[model samples]
Target: MGIRSVLSKPFAAFVVREQREWEQKAPDYQHKTLKNLVSKASNTVFGNDHGFKDIRTYDDFKKQVPVRDYEALKPYVEKMLTGQNDVLWPGKPAYFAKTSGTTSGTKYIPITKESIPNHINSARNAILNYVHETGNAKFLDGKLIFLSGSPVLDQKAGVNTGRLSGIVNHHVPGYLRTNQLPSYATNCMEDWEAKVDKIVEETIDQDMTLISGIPPWVQMYFDRIVEKRQMPVKDVFKNFSLFIYGGVNFEPYRQKLFDTIGKKVDSVETYPASEGFIAFQDKQDDPGLLLLANSGIFFEFIPADEYFNETPTRLSLDQVELNTNYALIINSNAGLWGYSIGDTVKFISKDPYKLLVTGRIKHFISAFGEHVIGEEVENAMKKTLESFPEADIVEFTVAPNVTPEKGLPRHEWYIEFSKMPADITAFKSSLDSSLQKLNSYYFDLISGNILEQLHIIPVKKNAFIDYMRSIGKLGGQNKLPRLSNDRKMAEELLKYKE
Candidate 1:
């Protein structure tokens, strides 16, 4: 029942075999395999139902099928929403992982029995690869705390669909599942207020060694720990061994976390989405991440330079060039083929194919056509925060606001500060000057008068979460969208005059 049995020696051996198979595959194997898989998947799902048959080659497939975002799958999703036996997958979906996308409302993404293998394998690959790289499986031996969403299942009629957290909770190795931890089924099903209360209660007395989740949730937990104990945050997490996180860049929040904890714990960044888990940190000092290519995915990269243009060229594993940024296009086993998830990444090295996640291709502000990526804003924020080490800027968002007087646009920064700065204007000027120096395009856009005013609005510590909660989006898998691409939500959140 232990991890040793669940992830047996033979299972570990199989992972090594898979990694080798991945490395030795022919140059065009990924492309060919993906094209074939997509054809089959389309046949399995849409072809029979929709009466479309000939989906074989890449060009043929592309021509026949229109590119679809998550929203377009609503009819299929709604069918599965009833917990019907055969709407999408072969059997009833065991759980529905609730995820929010840009254009889509909250999607109850089906996590069928067939799709469970992908999730399990992805999770295993992350762990096994960590062990393979570091030669240490004991790193996860201590009490691990996952800052997950509410585990409470819906008791309301027709609301019993399983969520991603619930699925993960149900599938974890029985031996590793601790009695000290709260069960998602029992605790997460409670009312939202009660769920948070249970989480707070369970974690308060535990000797938590490893922490994982979205950065904001982790921060919230630490805040609660400090408030309850009335002790410096460092004391509570003194025994913590690792901090594993994903969903957003950790650069902006790292210093604050370190300052709060007063100790440097190993931070592992993983690339996990409701669709699939993509990659994880391969080496301790190396900035590049290692893709779990062997785990139910065949990856493709579209060169970053050509990403925005029509008919961009895609490179397979062997075809991918080194040190260049590219938009990630994944063909996962869970029915997404040649899918553009909009994430952009760059290869730092190719020996083991280590990559650095640069930004999201779709998540950008181009009011004046500057094309500001997440990395630029992240780097600018890091530099600005480093300058004011004493300031506790919890979270920040950037938006391009248009002024009607001359029909000009500008970058406005909304920051949540734990402590109010005496010299707010000076702070704004410093941030603006640093940002302008950091990104020449942004600088030119501002200087040439295309983008007008640069403003910074400071708010209370939990302002962002409070704002999201007020919109009925505080809990579950949804995150506060930073780098507000369209600025609609940003404008709404910014209306609070503080």
Candidate 2:
């Protein structure tokens, strides 16, 4: 390695050390501090304007404050947009992280100066934990590539602010920044159609060792690289060392990613949303991802199965139970309090508050009243993949097609493949059998004849992206809807004749 590379290692080590100290101190100190912060913010925003007199205890805060979604905070966002700060967190909003939410539609989530620290610190903890797990910080001295969203954000006044990627881009230590690619990928111009070309060109010859992004987008990049170079993915990514990702579960794409690389590389998972950066994989052996408890937020967990009608129980860091899934609720200093972000996670342990993301509670199939979660679906897919090692399924979606005339509801599978199955009939049969065996609900529904049939629709490699593009939704952050729970959306996807 060159002298520049040698010098970069110590700087990275210093960052890791600072991050470790922060992580160690956070869980212990955050709860009380965050409660105080929330109380102060509540007083500032709604003390006189609204009815909230005070928010002292956890129970007092929960009972007094009604849960607010993105739409509920529109006025606050509008205030910031107009260059005024009338809510929690002082100073003008730094950037709005664009998020594609399930119920709320596309949202421009406000990221203020107060909120930016959470994102930065959570990301730093993810890196520090990676180094701690591998016992090395200099595992990848080569170029670090982030397959991120468009760096530029379009503003109403025609003066564009930087996107989250651009903000992070500016913050990265100048010494470590790579010259292999442009400071910013310009091809992601005003139009979304131009982004793929830019992404493809920038990633082609770069000797990238570390890559970070959502799995689907990264897979698309690899596919494009393969097509352009006319070479196997192994040749394109021979120097790659670490695969860091967030925004979605990696289990579905695990086999494909491994196959493309031709070997195993360290994989890291991050639990982050436009709302805030939450947790990250702390130890390689442990299934639980460590929560960034200290970052200007008070974390709370409500039982995953808890309904809106029922009074939800919120667990503090010390009170959280092991092995039970919970819907994450946050009361952050950045303005959101007792907010239901919609994602569900299960605790692996609570001594240090390690968690495993189960899935979005909204994303599930309940055709015959059999609530099939993301974990069950993931396991079922893994079992089916294990049975058919020869098949290369790229992306898949499941929909519950209820036929009242037939007196049953069945699951219809839409799958995209890089290579066609030689024994298509047998593959389908095996998948059905595996799913039935894995999930008791599936088995009972099939055995009881409530689920009449399983239909598999095969599509071209890029069919899903084409579908997404047709809807004017295509980018790094956007994903092909996994389990279309909406009846119309599910029906439309299932009845896709093409």
List model 1 lDDT by residue over 386-426, tens digit each: 77766767788888876644456677788888755667777
* Candidate 1's TM-score: 0.84
* Estimated TM-score for each candidate: 0.84, 0.88
Query: Per-candidate RMSD vs. true structure?
Result: 4.0, 3.1
C-alpha displacement of 465 in model 2, angstroms? 0.9
Overall lDDT per candidate, in order of appearance: 0.67, 0.69
lDDT of 2 by residue, 1-498 (tens): 655545545655776667566556655666676666665565455433443456566667667766666677666666666665545454445666666665567666666677777887677557666765566555346677776656666673222354566556555556456542434746246444466567678767877777788888777777677778988666886777778898778888888877776778888899887778888887777767877776777887788777354577777777777877788887776666667787888878656667888877678887677777777677777787777787777888888777645555678778887665778888778777877876788888888987865777876656777777767667666666567554665455544434
